[model samples]
Target: MEAIFALAVGIMAGAGIYLILRPRTFQVIIGLSLLAYAVNLFIFAMGRLRHGAPPVIDPRLGSDPALYTDPLPQALVLTAIVIGFATTALFLVVLLASRGLNGTDHVDGREPEDE
Candidate 1:
């Protein structure tokens, strides 16, 4: 499972980089989203991927590391997801407004034929 998560992170990062280099506003937005997801996954993975583990330590168990899961990474990932979503929506709206004003979706405010 760890290997799978690592592979997924790598794939997302690579695709995000590729998309970010493209010359389109929409691709750049999607690339940013992918990069945000990769970061979220990395942050979550940092807290460990233990299965069937409880979030809090049991007092009677006397601090058994193997029986508990870290809650910090989960909380951080949750916050990141919400922020990423809002930023993505904002970017989309701004992109739409820019397109309407300039009649182009290119980052430099010029049509492909003009370049």
Candidate 2:
């Protein structure tokens, strides 16, 4: 499971970097979203991967770190997911507006001519 998660994170980060380096505006937005997901996974992994562990500590368990998974990473990841979504939407809107004004999907204003 750990290996799988690590592989997923690596794949996402690699793909995100590749897409981010592309010339198209839409690809950059998608890359940003993928990067955000990779980051979220990295942060979540920092809290340690524990199966069947509750994030919230039970009162009866009496504040033992070993008994419960840390909730901080989970909370932060959740918040980041929401922020990433909003930023993706904003990026898409900006991309559309730029495309409309400049008449091209490329990052630069120049449109590629027909071959």
Candidate 3:
């Protein structure tokens, strides 16, 4: 499972980087989103991957650290998700406005020349 998770993160990061290098603005947005997702996953993974673990210490349980999962990473990821959504929305708005004003969705606000 750890291997799979690592592979997934790696793939996402790679794809994000590839898309970020593209000339299209939409692709760049998507790339940024993917990169954000990858980072979130990486951050979340830092909290240790434990199945069936409670996020907080139970009063009945003697406050052993191993009994509960680290909640910090979870909270950080949650906040990041919210921020990412807002930023994505803002990016979309800017993209639309730029498109309307410049009549192009390319990063440079102009159509690409044919090679």
**Candidate 1 lDDT, tens digit per residue, 1-115?**
9999999999999999999999889999999999999999999899989888877777887787767899889988999999999989999999999899999889878877754
Q: 47-75 in candidate 3: lDDT tens per residue?
A: 99888898988898878998999999999
Clashes of each: 0, 0, 0
Ordered by lDDT, highest first, the candidates read: 3, 2, 1
Which sections of candidate 3 miss by over 4 Å?
Answer: none
Q: Show pairs that collide, candidate 2.
A: none
Segments of candidate 2 deviating more than 4 angstroms = 60-62, 112-115
Q: Residue 14 lDDT in model 3?
A: 98
Give the C-alpha lDDT of model 1.
Answer: 0.90
Error of 2 at 36 (Å): 0.8
Clashing pairs in 3: none
In Å, residue 24's CA in model 2 sits off its true spot by: 0.7
Candidate 3 TM-score, C-alpha based: 0.92
TM-score of 2: 0.91
